[model samples]
Target chain A: MSESEYAIEVENLNIYYGNNHVIKSINLKIPQKTVFAIMGPSGCGKSTMLRSFNRLLDLNKNVRVNGSVHLFGRDIYTGDMDSVEVRREVGMVFQYPNPFPHLSIYNNIALGLKMNKLVKSDKELDERIEWALKKAGLWEEVKHRLNDYPSGLSGGQRQRLVIARVIAMKPKVIMMDEPTANIDPVGSKKIEDLIFELKKDYTIVLVTHNPAQAARVSDYVAFIYLGELVEAGETGKIFTAPESKLTEKYLTGKLV
Target chain B: MYQFDMRRIKEYSFLGVISLLSFFMIFPLFHIIFTVFVDGIGTLVSTGPVFITGTLDDGGIGPAILGTLILSFFASLIGIPIAFAVGVYAYEYPYSVIGKATTALLEITQEFPTILVGLFVTQILVLPMGTYSAIAGAFALAIILMPYVAVYTKEAMSQIPFSFREAAFSLGVTKVKTVFLIIAPIAKRGILTGLLISVAKVAGETAPLLFTAGGLYQTYPDSLTQPVGAIPLLIYTLVQSPSPADHAMAWGASLVLLLIFLAAFIPLRLSIKEVRM
Candidate 1:
């Protein structure tokens, strides 16, 4: 594969929170326009590693990063490159559905666009918001109530709204950290289908604790435990054959 | 059976002592409000509207009311911006050395005696200008007002969960934009409550105005540099006079001051009870 085929190239990545070594040395090559899954048990440093992709880990005072994460061949954590600019290119959806509650639905979608000057005029902004919402499978449900707050929406709808917020930026890579963990079963199913639809246009890096969900959605899978990658390969190959005892144990529900 | 009965007796005694102490604590406030209304209402009725509109000769407190308003407004204008900036900085970088020092200084200043502030302003402003002025009084009040607004702002921002901060930053917004536009707006109700409560506090202050405000009740404040009389300062001066009429005037002024305080405080108190100290 060509070097340009990778959406994100994390090299010798290590993260620390004060005295604790959270993410030990690791390297990952996530392909463009595919659903790449990182699965681990809870508190296994999976979430901490995802945050470093967009420099969100920089918000924590105790965290220290010691490697480079390249986005489309541009090293994001190095000199002359801006983290704000990096965030615009890499959008993330958290475990919880967090839309800006104080803003109206219309404004929630428009905030990043307006703040970053992504769109030109009022008409352009409205068009982009409508487009993003439609892409996220939320436009029909919320079209009539665009001026309302997100507090009135259901958990699944709010999560889709968050997805719309990220999509409005037209980012190259989208990171989802257990996006459906808090939603109802029906809501989770809808998001799973939406994720399948989204992978055609954007690279989706999903973090999940459930192996079955990873098998159902992701094209490639990596199992991490105790801050180390135990195994990584195509989703089909990893599920069928055993590469490492740790990977087999984790898949069999014996490693957690 | 005996243990249950003993527990019931202990509970009743705790309730009884708590209610008794609470009533004792609130008794003085009620007694003071009752006395002020009884003595002050007559002065207000007999004097009519002039009681609020006229000068000392006309037996009105218009100048003092105007003075108090000017002082509070300007003090807020001077203090709120500085205090708000300090508070947000303290909230944003709380673990840093400067941030910790700022929080400690704010707490210390809150407990510092108000009289010393008055004396400091008197030396720096009044003595240099060669007269007691409203500006000097407002400056002193602004110093006292800073700690209240800054501490409240810090508390309000800290009350927000860390998740919101992450959500805002993840949107690619700069830290400045995230702090001022996003985070601050979410904390607006608490910040506004702080502004109103501090204004109410400074409006009722008398000791800070002793040497700063020269006590002018004869006329309305024509300029910021001129001497002025506040309702609290007027009451303080009237109570010391040997005249019976002055004592009546003091009671009426006290009533006016109390009303001002309630007008600002009650609605805010109703809207946000948790802002209470």
Candidate 2:
């Protein structure tokens, strides 16, 4: 894709939680239709920087941000821009699979569409839910029991349901923050496979501590250290021919 | 090894003694329920017609029953909503000075004695409405119930997971709807339980009503401005009287009051058990 097709751009980003500087000055770019993985040790600001893309950090009462993040060539943090509209275009999936305990599988997927008023009729809603579920690879497994509560689903199934919920909104960028942390190895692999399948249609940004997991899925990788961007490039080059000593140590599991 | 066996035996005996103390602690409730049945049965039989009919001169508790029902019902009707809003705001959106002040006031009010509540309401709502008015009685009961409902609702709302809130927020739902639709629905059962307990507590309180609502009488108020007689007030009057028949009506009235409270509580308790913990 050309430079004009860039999906997201971050310049001179700094994030603070009260007095603590959690994310330092950093810059990066993610193009359309690609999966970008952010890897780092615990508390290195990978998650903070990921959340800053859509201003999810604004949820924290202590958080303050100074810098600019752009989505599709538009500044996201500007006064005239609505945070709700930004989130609508850039959807997020949390660490744990949260499918809204009180709602059914079908209702959970339909919730986002309903919020946007994207569907006007019952038949349209039904088809939208089916399409999203199929995209997330959960449609066949849960098709027969659409009305059942989401809490009854297995861990893998719940994660897919969450993905389905987000993808149904037709967000241009889908961000996952350690989405497989709570599930088993088998379930993690399934989600990894699903993420690869998802990048064909939407830009994906994921934060992970596991270099191997990042290698298996991401088209590009960015290594963050103490809130600073250590290195970022094509996934193969970053892993096989890393220029920074810190990146080499982190990739070899010698320093995390 | 010998010392270990002796220690084990000592612990067993200590457990047995503590278990016996628990029975002693609970015995008073049994004594009260048992005594009411034995003491009130004869009164119920002889005055059975008057008891249900509530027609005997200077006797019967119809006015008191009517007063207690109306007063406590109105109290809960007013108090439950206030409690829910205060609880949700205090726990969920507690960034304001007003919310902080309300939470602190509620905590202090919960520990205040019922008679003090009577005094406060007498000065605030009761004196304004006039003593013996049904409105004053309702206000008195509401004052007693508010603290309980607020404290319990806050506790229940706090127990809800932050994940639920984050999930709702991430969905692009506004914070207000996220609170009411997602958080409040999950906390409803606990709120209902608190309201029921508050109802029972207000139903049985005699001290608060004494000053705000005047003694038992046959006259029924046509409006909130008029004097009202509640069951507790009637029981107090009959217990003070010289006539044996009047005293018997007191016990019967006490029994009826106990049953009324239990009837309100049983379903609330059972249904609350079904809510997700």
Top candidate by TM-score: 1
Model 2 C-alpha lDDT versus the unseen true structure: 0.83
> Candidate 1 — which residues are off by over 4 angstroms?
A1-3, B1-4, B267-277
| Among all candidates shown, the one with the greatest DockQ | 1
Q: What are the clashing pairs of model 1?
A: none
Task: List, residue by residue over B1-277, the lDDT tens digit for candidate 2.
Answer: 4455888899999999999999999999999888787777777787765674464364566767778888888888887788777887887656678878888999898877888877877788766655557777788788778888888888777777876776666667777877777777677777778778878888888888888777555654466767777888788878899988787777888887877777878866886742332
Q: Write candidate 1's Cα lDDT for B87-128 as tens digits.
A: 999999999999999999999998889999999999999999
TM-score of chain B of each: 0.94, 0.89
| Model 2 per-residue lDDT at A20 | 97
Query: Which number leads on lDDT?
Result: 1
Off by over 4 Å in 2: A1-4, B1-7, B10-14, B49-59, B124-131, B215-222, B242-244, B273-277
**Native-to-model Cα distance after best TM-score fit, residue B239 in candidate 1, in Å:** 1.3
